[model samples]
Target: MTDTIFSARQRLSANMRWMRFIVLALAVFFLYSLAQDGFSGRDNVESMTDHLIVLFFCCLHIVFYIVFDRSKVLEFDAGFLYVKSKNGEEKVALSSIHIIRLSSIRLGYIRLWELVYLDEMNNSKSVSFQPLDRQVFSRFQEMVKIANPVVQINRFRFL
Candidate 1:
């Protein structure tokens, strides 16, 4: 079998979108404060503090986007499943996955949760990852089915 790699662009979650909005609001407030003070001609201390606070919040928002906004794709090839990220990659042997759980959220979103067998300590470990689109999830499910037909998948419940 040939090894394959799949890559997809990640998007911010709904929760992150709200966070970005809050950051934008804070930036606007900071600008308004500066404008009210006649382009910051006076109140040097207050202006500096306001500008610093705005800068910190803007940095926080940017950091969050960098960490979570990228999409990840699952690759199954040559008896291995690889989870790749911008920083690094993780690989799990197909046979080592004890369980493959499928869960859905808000109607259309599918999350894949894997319970993997740790070879070093002979213990089980759980990990979860989300695909960029429903089609990707479907492809993942199909690949898992073909590779490990009897793998048990726990249904995810939300409440």
Candidate 2:
């Protein structure tokens, strides 16, 4: 029996847009204030520190969400990987794939797996998601090799 390479049942990329928007709002609010009044006086300095603290906590929340907010994954028994994300659902056939480009995308301190598949139509589709389990990601990598031996694997690094 062929095992599932990758599977996600819940919306992994869902709620991401809202989180980013919240962070952006915090930045905009504080940045405009900073521009209006230059850093001066003890009271202004104290107020700026308080706002900075709020910003730091907001960023921390995002980091926690990225690391712990995992999705549910069952199986892809149909020989197709079913993806349900913020962008909706899509299924890519294993056999119709000509290339599987592997990469990573980062939002804040977290990193997600990026898969770009070249389908039979010569079109490329990309999926960015965190696997339900780390073991699943390793298994998926091996499965990619078995499915498309000539697939291009990119080694991603953060400096």
Candidate 3:
């Protein structure tokens, strides 16, 4: 069988959902601050910091959304699965994959679903892949099964 390249769509979807939730919460907080102090005149650094923080979060969410949304496909070639990020590329190898663990806590958290990849021969190359949904996770698992059937998958009750 041919090798499977796993995408990060599931993880991105979960991240996007949480980002939306955070944005909504921030909007409520902004409104609450406006209602309490009025936007007429505020020269306090704390208030400025709050606004800055919210802006910073919004920008970060936007950037993350764009990158994840754009990278719909991941390519697996030879021993590596290529990760295309906004900044550059990251290659993860099958031999480097040490453990695949399913998380129970923070069910919808973006990075909760993790596949820990470790390279004992090269300490600097250890990495992890966090795919958000069952479909993608399963696909990845299947790929790993095909690539290396001996690899262990750790399943635990999520809290």
Span of 10 residues, lowest total lDDT, candidate 1 = 9-18
lDDT of 3: 0.54
Could you give candidate 1's per-residue lDDT for residues 4-68 as a string of tens digits? 34333222112222344555566566556556665647767776787677667666656655534
Q: Candidate 3, which segments miss by more than 4 Å at Cα?
A: 1-79, 107-111, 119-121, 124-136, 157-159
Which residue pairs does candidate 3 place in steric collision?
A: 11-132, 104-158
**Model 3, span 44-108: residue lDDT tens:** 98877876766666566565555444432344544556555555666667666666666553524
Deviating ranges (above 4 Å) for candidate 2: 1-18, 24-78, 96-109, 157-159
Question: Which is the winner by TM-score between candidate 1 and candidate 2?
Answer: 2
TM-score of 1: 0.45
Question: What TM-score does each of the candidates earn?
Answer: 0.45, 0.48, 0.48
Q: In candidate 2, what are the lDDT values of residues 56-87, reduced to their tens digit?
A: 76566566445433332223323455665444
Clashes of 1: 1
The deviation in Å at residue 108 for candidate 1 is 12
Root-mean-square deviation (CA) per prediction: 7.8, 7.5, 7.3
